[model samples]
Structures are given as structure tokens and as C-alpha cells.
Target chain A: SQQGEEDPQALSIQEGENATMNCSYKTSINNLQWYRQNSGRGLVHLILIRSNEREKHSGRLRVTLDTSKKSSSLLITASRAADTASYFCATPYVISYGKLTFGQGTILTVHP
Target chain B: EPEVTQTPSHQVTQMGQEVILRCVPISNHLYFYWYRQILGQKVEFLVSFYNNEISEKSEIFDDQFSVERPDGSNFTLKIRSTKLEDSAMYFCASRGRLRDSYEQYFGPGTRLTVT
Candidate 1:
């Protein structure tokens, strides 16, 4: 079984600063995704990076995957207070029916 | 921008009672799933449904748990007997049928508190 573990469990930054979160997994995966959950709310998809891809960008999010290390990182540039939430890294099973194994998550608080 | 919809933003039940959490996935999507997050804990996958049947399920999905797509557009998760540990936020998610499409859209989630 593969599981993702995120580092620096909690982070606090000022608005407009850069926030980076790291995730490491235990097994191989075809793709890794990042999701954001506001306090007590459902998760919102942030970005996905494939095994072959080193990096991917969507809006202000930058996700980097390093298969050799079985790790990935999510960088949010120009952060805002709205970005205050728990960010989780999830890896889909190799068989792919979209069953995701999620990380413990990084609790990021961007202060305005 | 179609999204998954779940009923009863919050549910309160007593222990040993049966509870059914409902979700209406995106109309065009073919895969549906249920996940739960305990307060202050990580989100955990419970089960995945596709083509009118469960494709995969986690060990947490035990004999007390059951899922059904009784209609073409609705997916439901039933707990035969709820326990205090079942208290958590239950989320419903769905994605398209493409082999390479892996992005899952999640609903607002239902907060279940078993007393």
C-alpha cells in the first residue's frame, strides 16, 4: 500500500509571499494530485503532475514531481488570505479507477 | 462547470442507527467515489463506484457499509449501524471516463455526527 506524507505539517506566511509544501510517497504512482480544503469544507483540486513530468503549472500553483525520490512539491506563488487552508497531496493507484490515497496534509495559513 | 452535489449538509444520528448519505455526481461523469475525513485527520477513501458496481473499496468499508447507484444519476452510501467513530465529514466525488482523466471534483460534503 502506498501512502503520501507531507512535511512541515503547518505553515504560516504573509500575503504575497511564496508557500511551498512537500510530499513523499511509499510506492510507484502514475500521477499525483494536490487538493485544497477550506476549514470544514470539501476539497478543491489544485493541480496534478504525472510520473514522467517533472513540473506542472496551473494559475498560481506549481507542482513538481520527482519519481526517483518518490516525492513531489507544491508551490503557490503570490499567496493570498484566501489560500489559507489544508493542502493535501494524493496519489492515485496504478490501476487508476481514481481511488486516491491522501497525505496527512500541510496546513497553510496566509495572513493578509 | 458541473459539480457533485450531496444532500444534508449535516446529519445527526444515534449509535446503532442506520444512515444513508446521498450524492448526485456530475451528469456526464462515469466514476463516483466516497471519502471521509475525521476532524483533524486526513481524508480517507472509502469506496469507488463505476458502471453500476463498486470497482474498489478500502478495508474501512466493512460489512456495515454498502453503496448503490439505484438510479442513473444518484449514488448513495449506507451505514447499517453507525458508531461514534463514524462521525466525520463525508465527501462525494466524481470524474470523467477517459483513461487518462484523473481529476476528481468533490462535493461540499456532509458532516455526520454520531452520538
Candidate 2:
């Protein structure tokens, strides 16, 4: 199974600033997903990019995947206080076949 | 919008006790899953169920854990004789059937505190 590891274990940025986090994984993957979890709560799926795709966008969020580096990056533009949450990158693998393996996560704190 | 719902948002039990976490996935979804997140750690997949059977499970899922679709809408995960290490938040998720594309919807987790 592929295990995604997010860089900058913790990040703090001012509201309206852009925040970027990187994730690297072990083994090959079918797709990579990004999710956000509020403190002590369930996770909300943000975006997903397949192995063949390079970049994807949803509103203010942009995700880029570099297969050769076996890594992916998530960039949140013009962040807000509501964006304060743990951002996790997950890679789907065949071991648990289609099950997602998540990263330790980047605890993002956006200050107003 | 449809959302997955879980029961008993929080549970407190003693070691060696039995616990059953219930989840009501989105009405039209076909795939269900269980995952756990220990404090200050990553989310871990426990099991995934489809067609009333476990399609896959993680090493963390041992004999003590079992899952069943007791009815059409409810999915349950039973942990027998829970250990202190069982303290974590358990999340239930569902996904519509898609061979090439899969987007899972997760329910608010149940925080289990094993005392």
C-alpha cells in the first residue's frame, strides 16, 4: 500500500495568504485525494487527481501531481480562518484495493 | 445534499468491553468503510464492505473486529473485548460505485474512549 507523507507537519499563515503543502508517497498509486478534518471531527473530501493528471482546481484550491517524483502538492489560495484544519493527502492502492492510505497530515492554522 | 450519519457520537467503555459503532451511509451509495484515527496520528483504514461482505481489511483489523450490514441502510462495526489501545475516533464512509472514479463521503466520527 502507498503511504503519503505530507511535508511541513504544521503550518501557520495569515488569512488571505496562500498556503502550500507537499506530500510524497511510497509505491505506485491509482489516484491521490485531499481531505480536510476539523478539530475532532470527520473528514471532508476536497479534491482528487488521477495518476495521469497533472493539476486540478476547485475554487481557491489547486492540486498538482508529479508522478516522476511520486509526490503531490496542494495549494490553498487566499486562505481564511475557516480553512484552519488538518489537511491530509491520501493515495489509493491495491493492497486494500481501492482503500485510501492517508498521510500524517499538515495541521494548517489560518489566522485572521 | 446527502450525508453519512453515525450514531452515539461518543462512546466510553472499559477494557474488555464490547462496542458497536453504527453508520447510516448515503441512501444511494454502494460501498462502505471503517477507519480509525489515533490521537496525533494518521487515519488508518480498518475495513471496506461491499455486497454484504468484506472486500478488504487492514492489518490493524484483527479477529476482534467484525462488520455487518444488518439491514439495507445500516452498517455496523463490532469490536469485542476492546483493548485500551482501541481509544480513537472511528469514521464511517460510503462511496457510489465507480470502477474508474471513486469519491467517498465520510460521516462524523465516533470518538471511542477505552478506559
Candidate 3:
């Protein structure tokens, strides 16, 4: 089952602008992770936020989790054209230790 | 930096035929996973392997699907009978060890086409 579902199926922004994507899951999660994928390429792990942690950051990426609301968001500040890709949120099932359920993903196109 | 690797970037098979997708995870990683994504669809988890046995599997991982660590470095996902609906991009992932901050590294993925 697909637990996480990203909003704004697609997004487009100019270079240097900020881009934000949101994801909502249907059940409890121990942690939520964000990943990026280039066209026809493998997924790249970006940042992960545990259920106890409200927020986390790495480089230009900022991820926030609202466990109470079962929602999370990924923000890319000062986005560059190179950041163009699909972003997905993944979470392991509450009862399944290592099985990761991924979101539908948001396609972001950073225009130069 | 060690990274996971997969073989036969693309595989084309006829329906009902058997197919195997191979992956070589990071040398020191202990957990291995298999996932698949249909074109323009979300990535779905199939199964996870640890201690040379399956730790957990998703509903999508039916009896037709099986995983094996044929050698020290090779992890493979075999489909007993391929179906046209089985066509998708299969990905292999691995993580170093169990920890609060562990992250899974993914391979380039093998594009499977079943006719």
C-alpha cells in the first residue's frame, strides 16, 4: 500500500527561488525520509526526519514533520536548475521493520 | 565511496518466461531491499533481506517473486513467470547497518519489459 501521497503533483520554479513539496501519510511512521531522482536514474537519499524530530536540515534542503497531522514537507531554498528532479517521501510501515512505502512523488522543474 | 550496482540495465522477456534481476550491494551493507516502479507510478517495496533471509515483504511480493544471496556480493530477485503487467523498473537498495540514522543506497535500476 502507498502510505505517503505528495501534493501538487508537479511544480515549476525559477532558479534561486524556493520550492516546497508536501506529503501526507495514512498511518503511523517511525521516520520519514526524502529522496531525489534525476531523469531515469536511481534515487538519492536527501534528508530523514524521525518521528520525534520536528525538523531537519541538510545543505539547501529543509524537511519538517508534523506527526500529529501525519504530514511532512520538503523545502529547497535558493533552488538551482540542477535541482530539477522528482522528489519522494518514504516511510517504513509501522509493523514492518524494513519495508519502505514511498509516496507518489512530486516532479519539480527548476528553470534556469 | 562504495555504491550498490545492478546488472543488465535492461531486460526484455516474453510473458510466462522466467527472469532474474541482479544486484551487488555495498560490501559492508547488511540489509538489502528490492523495489519496483511502473512508468509514471510510485515506487513500491517488494521485499527486504537480512541475515541471508527475508525480513519482511509487501503484498506485491507474491509467491512468484523470490530473492537470494547467491554469493557474498550478489543479491538477485527472480520472477518465476513474467507477465506484461510485471514490466517496470526494478531497483535494488542496501544500507550499512541498523541505526537511527541509517539510509538506504539505491542502484541505477534495471528496466524490465515483459511482452
Candidate 4:
């Protein structure tokens, strides 16, 4: 079964605006990571936030994890048309090593 | 920037026929994984391999599904008999040594169409 479930099935915003996507999971995790997919081709790794971490940033992408709530959120600042794609949050099953459960994902569209 | 790569960008096969999806991971990576995404669906994990053995797999990976690392860098997933429901985009991924990080590099998926 899918462990994580992303909110906002789809979102549209103008370039230069900020986009936020949230994900909720059901189990304990060593870490949570975010990925982006373009037209269902391949998933591009975005950022990872360990269980002990509350927030992390990479370039314009900011991610936050609230293990207590078993949720995470990804925020893209100053979005660009190129940022348009499906974003997913993934987590490793508590007991399974290397196996990741992916979320449904959120489709973000940035209009220039 | 080394990346994982899969061959036969797309494959069309008849139901009941066998199919093998091949992948070449980054030379220095050790962990290999197979995932699939059905049309308009989220990506699902199939299996993860390490040390020439299956480390983990999801319920979706049944007896009909098998994974192999034929050689050092080439990893393959084979389906004993294709089913119409098996049609999906298959992706191969790999990550470097454990000490590096948990980041995985995914290859361009191979679209499998079982008719």
C-alpha cells in the first residue's frame, strides 16, 4: 500500500509565485525525501529530511518534516514555468531496508 | 553526472509472453531498485537488490516477478508471463555506497504495453 499521500491533487500558479505541497504518511521513517517527475518519465531527487530534522533547503526548494504528525511539506519559492511537474514525497518503510513508499503526488503548473 | 539508464525505451508484448527489462546503473553504485507506474497512477516500488540478492520487495512483486543483476553494472527485471494489467512504465534506480546518502538516481522508464 502507498504510505504517503500528497495533498492538493493539482495546483496552478503564476511564475514568481510560491507553490506548496503537503504529504502525510502512516508509519515511522528514517527519513523523508521529495522527488519531481516530468511527464511520468523519471523521478528527480529533490531534498531529503531525516527524522531528526525539522527543515531543510536546497536552492529555492524548502522542505519541512514533522515526524510527530507524520507529515512533510515542500515549498518552491519564486516558481518558474520550468517548475511545472508532478512532485512526490517518499519514505522508507520502517523495517524494510532501501524500499521506499511513494505518495500519490501533486501536479503543479506554473504559468509564465 | 553519471545516471542510471534503461534500454528499449518502450516494449510492446502479448499477454502470457515473457519480458525482461534491463538497466545499467551508475558504475560506482551498489544498490539497485525497480519501480513501476501505471497510467495516471503513482509510482510503486517493486523490489530492491543489493549484494547480488533481493533485499526487499512489495506485495506487488509476486512469484511471477524476478530481479537479477546479470553482471556488475547491469540489473534486470523479468516477468514470467505478461498480463494486460502489467502494462505500465518500469523504472530502474540506483544509489551509491551506503555511506554516501539515501539519494537514488532513476533512469528514464521503459513503457511496457501488454496486449
Highest-TM-score candidate: 1
Q: All candidates' TM-scores?
A: 0.98, 0.97, 0.96, 0.97
Measured with C-alpha atoms, the lDDT of residue A85 in candidate 3 is 97
Candidate 2 vs candidate 3, TM-score winner: 2
- Tell me the lDDT of model 2 at B111: 95
Off by over 4 Å in 4: none
DockQ of each: 0.89, 0.78, 0.81, 0.80
- Per-residue lDDT tens digits for candidate 2, residues B33-112, read 99999998889999999888999998999999999999899999999999999999999999886766577889999999
Model 2 residue A44 CA deviation in Å: 0.3
Name the weakest run of 10 consecutive residues (lDDT summed) in model 1 chain B.
B94-103
Docking class of 3: high
Number of the top candidate by DockQ? Answer: 1
DockQ computed for model 2 against the true two-chain complex using alpha carbons: 0.78
Off by over 4 Å in 3: none
How many backbone clashes does every candidate have?
0, 0, 0, 0
User: Interface RMSD for each candidate model?
Assistant: 0.8, 1.2, 1.1, 0.9
TM-score of model 2 (CA atoms) = 0.97
Give the least accurate 10-residue stretch of model 4 chain A, judged by summed lDDT.
A92-101
lDDT of 2: 0.92
- Write candidate 1's Cα lDDT for B1-89 as tens digits: 78899998999999999999999999999999999999998899999998898999999999999999997988999999999999999
Tens-digit lDDT track for model 1 on A6-109? 98899999999999999999988999999999999999998889899999999999999999999999999999999999999999989758899999999999
Residue A36 of model 3: what lDDT? 95
- Output the TM-score of candidate 1: 0.98
Q: Against the hidden true structure, what lDDT does model 1 obtain?
A: 0.94
For residues B11-106, write the lDDT of model 3, one tens digit per residue. Answer: 999999999999999998898999999999989889999899999988889999999998889999999999999999999999877545457899
